[model samples]
Target chain A: MRRSIVNDPDDLVAEALEGLVLSHPTMLELDAEHRYISRKQKARDKVGLVSGGGSGHEPLHSGFVGTGMLDVAVSGAVFASPTALQVLAGTKAADAGRGVVQIVKNYTGDVLNFRIAGEISGDDAIDTEIVLVDDDLASDTGEDDGPGRRGTAATVIVEKICGAAAENGMDLQQVAAVGRTVAQRSRTMSLALAAGTHPGDDEPQFTLDADEVEFGVGIHGERAQRRIPFTGADELIEQLVDPLLEELELGRGTEVLAIVNGLGSAYPLELSLAARALHRRLDTDGITVGRSLVGSYVTSLDMHGVSITLMPLEDELRELWDAPVRTPALTW
Target chain B: MRRSIVNDPDDLVAEALEGLVLSHPTMLELDAEHRYISRKQKARDKVGLVSGGGSGHEPLHSGFVGTGMLDVAVSGAVFASPTALQVLAGTKAADAGRGVVQIVKNYTGDVLNFRIAGEISGDDAIDTEIVLVDDDLASDTGEDDGPGRRGTAATVIVEKICGAAAENGMDLQQVAAVGRTVAQRSRTMSLALAAGTHPGDDEPQFTLDADEVEFGVGIHGERAQRRIPFTGADELIEQLVDPLLEELELGRGTEVLAIVNGLGSAYPLELSLAARALHRRLDTDGITVGRSLVGSYVTSLDMHGVSITLMPLEDELRELWDAPVRTPALTW
Candidate 1:
């Protein structure tokens, strides 16, 4: 039997939203009717920033709906994309006379739904732009074939930088450009020791042997490119970092921001160990780390793994990242 | 066949500490020689706060060290208490002449070690007071035999409130008194759907049947007082909340603060759903929750469960709880 602490699996998303709103009443407002969350105190006449995906990734899109991050987030069910109608409602709620920027991760369902929502918003005379994030090095299919790279934890970095830009009164085009720039510069790869089980499912999406690990695993438990025998932390870090460095074309004297994110069930102790290895490896490679975030920012539901995201930083991007942010999941 | 991404099991705690210091360079300073973490910017002539225990409970003691929480934390090996020598060093590092307050959990080793450290600090002419936290109702030994109760997540609340009091320049006795009051009023009970595995251990600290849950499990994964067949969320909440309410003597119009904390591996989605159920139950019972914090405040390594901590709040306690705090795991 699947063990869970849920009322009805169908009601999990809505109930979680209620809890979030209740805990952060001053910062967030819930539209139960349309199923979206919006900032209680939105900036006037500034471009509104919005992003969302499956509901299981708590504090990702929803935990980020506050003063310095997203203006609105439309949550879907666990490991599922939000409907187009929900995204349209989010755009309407986030609008403040200025245009809205829709940040979409590169997933088939998410891309299609967010695009449809943008079209609807245009028809309603609310100017909207979509910034596609595709930074996953794991799913890299060269240049032409397949569906580009899957968007992973880099979406958090994009939202944060773009949110700061929009809050500083950047126009819609400028904010969207900032998002696109960060997304282009960022790359991520994940390794999983165990797979995550979706709600109402007794078995995991996939299983690994005790001495094995899956490399390049997607956030939704999609099959990875390969599985390898379990090794110590150093070997794993090398496997993740080499590809990321090559993708970013980074070398000695290059300043970059590194994010070591936990995929839900990995303890902070484990994440910290992974981060230590990442920093040491970067130092050995003569890279300069301008800033770093290590924790569970974006997560696959209870998956025991970690993802490394590196964004080669420029002065402008660094300054924007350093700007103050107040959200449930992040504060500085 | 143990599975983990650690350098060496013996070096796990030190490596994790190094990672933490690197991530929060401006806020935390590590004394690896003494096995303690201290604030980079210590407050002069103010009462200092110190707390720690085993290492697996990330963000508990170490993550709580910063401006509005602990001044220093002395970490032991995973799931083991720090030595008296280490605690003495932490006390010395945190002292600012106003004195120091040591917040200790109720486990025998922790209590003894912290007390010995207090005596040694007194010999060094540094005034030190130890506040014993024993809020676990699950391990309550009624009125007589054994230690009063095992400390659990309520230590977070006590540290936060007392740290605020100390930061506001309260004397050592005053700060220690505040911690005592909060501990006296607070009560916690935890339920584990699965047991946690310690580092390097091939087997879990304990085991449970797939369809069974242990109520009142200790943070160290000690066997629970009772086991029952698995039930849905509502029934589990009732089993937890009723005992907590009775222990707290809370009723209609009584103000309280509630924490729905995750044991190590529980997903955020599950924690949020549990928080929602907790709120609805409190409403049905006619209690006024002045403040609330829900997340993984304390954890057993990779345990799949949640703990509920309730503290009947007074206006003073609520004010202290609402004070500004900035730390690795918590910021507001």
Candidate 2:
């Protein structure tokens, strides 16, 4: 039996949003009819920013709907993309005369739905630009092959930088360009020690042996490219960091923003140790980390693993990232 | 076979601290020799607040060492109390010529160690006051009974409020008094859907059947007062809230600051739903929720459960709770 505390799996997304709005009444407003969350104080005449995909990744898109990040977020049921109608509602709610930017992670359903929403918004005379985030190095099969890289934790980086740019009154094209730039500069790779069980399902979406770890696992519990025998933190960090460094083409003295994100159930102690190893390895490689964030920013429901995202920082992106943000999740 | 990502269980705490100092270089300084984390910018001539218990409860003590919360945090091994010498180091590090206040959880080990540190600080000519937090209603006995109550998530409340008071330049006695008051006004009850495994241990500290939940479980994974068949969120909230209301002697028009905290592995989706149910129930009882925080403020390592902490808000306490705070885990 699945021992989830949910009242009903069907109502989980709506109820969670209700709780979010209740806790942050002054900062957020719920569009109950259309099923989206918008900033209580909408930015005026600025290019609106919005992003959402699935529900279980709490604080990712929804916790980010506030002053310095997304203006609206349309949440779907767990690990599933929201309907195009819901995304369209989000775009309309966030638009303030200026065009809106739709940040879509590189997932089949999400990409299709967000594109449809953009088309619908265009018909309604709301200029909507879709910025695709494809930063997962694990899913990389060259720019021409497959669906490109799956967007992972790097979406946080893209949203934050683009949100700051838009808030600074950048036009829709400029904000979208900023989002794409960061997404291009960023890369992420994750490993899963244990798979997460989906709601209403007793079995995990995937299973791993006690001594095995799935490297390059997707956020939705998709199988990694390879399963490797479990070693330890040092080995794991090396496995994650090497590919990220190669993908970013980073080397000595390169300034980077590093994120060590937990995939939900990984404890802080483990995440911290992973961070320590990652930092030491980076230092050994002569990289200068300009900024670092370590936490469960983007999660894969209660999956026990971690993902490391590295974004080589240019002066502009760094400045945008340093700009003040006051969201429920990323406040600095 | 244990499947932790850590390199070594013995060095886990220190490695974690190294990671924390690296992530928040401007805000924190780790004293490796003394095993305590001190604020980089010390609050001069103001009562300094110091707190710690065990290491597994991330963002509890160490994560709160910053501008508006703890001045120093002494971490022990996971789920073990720090030594008196370690606590004394924290006291010395936090003192800025005014005085220091030690916030201690109600566990016997923590109480004894903090008390010893206080006495030692007094001998060193540093005025130190120890504020004992005993707020777990599940472990409550008569006022004079053994240990009063076990401290749980309410420790977060006492520390935040008292830290604000101390940061506002309250005297040592005043800050200590504020801590005690909040502890008195607060009550917490936790239920464990599953027990957390200690580092290096193949088995969890305790266990419950899939359909069973242990109510009133301690943060250290101590068995609860009783085991009951697993119900849904509504029943769990009721079971927790009714006792809390009775213990608080609260009714219509009473105000409270409710914290629906996750104990490690509980997903945010569950936590938010729990918060929603909790708020609706509080409304049905005609209670005015003055403020609310719903997240994993305190945790038992990888335990899949939630703890609800209710702190009745008086005017002074509410003001203190609302004050600005910037820490690794909390910023507002």
* C-alpha DockQ of every model: 0.70, 0.74
lDDT of 1 by residue, B34-79 (tens): 8899999987878999999988998889999998889999999999
Distance from true location, Cα of A311 in model 2, Å = 0.5
Candidate 2: stretches off by over 4 Å: A143-145, B143-145
TM values, all candidates: 0.98, 0.98
lDDT by residue for model 1 over A1-332, one digit each (tens)? 33778778899899889888887778889999777989888779899888998877776889888877899999999989999999999988989989999999999889999899999999889999999999888898887978899988999999999989998989999999999999999999999988887876777888888888999999999889899888877789779999898877898988889999998888888888998898888999899778988888888888889999999888899999999898878888
| Fraction of the true interface contacts (Cα pairs closer than 8 Å across chains) found in each model | 0.68, 0.73
Comparing only chain A of model 1 with the true chain A, what is the TM-score? 0.98
- Evaluating just chain A, the predictions reach TM-scores of 0.98, 0.98
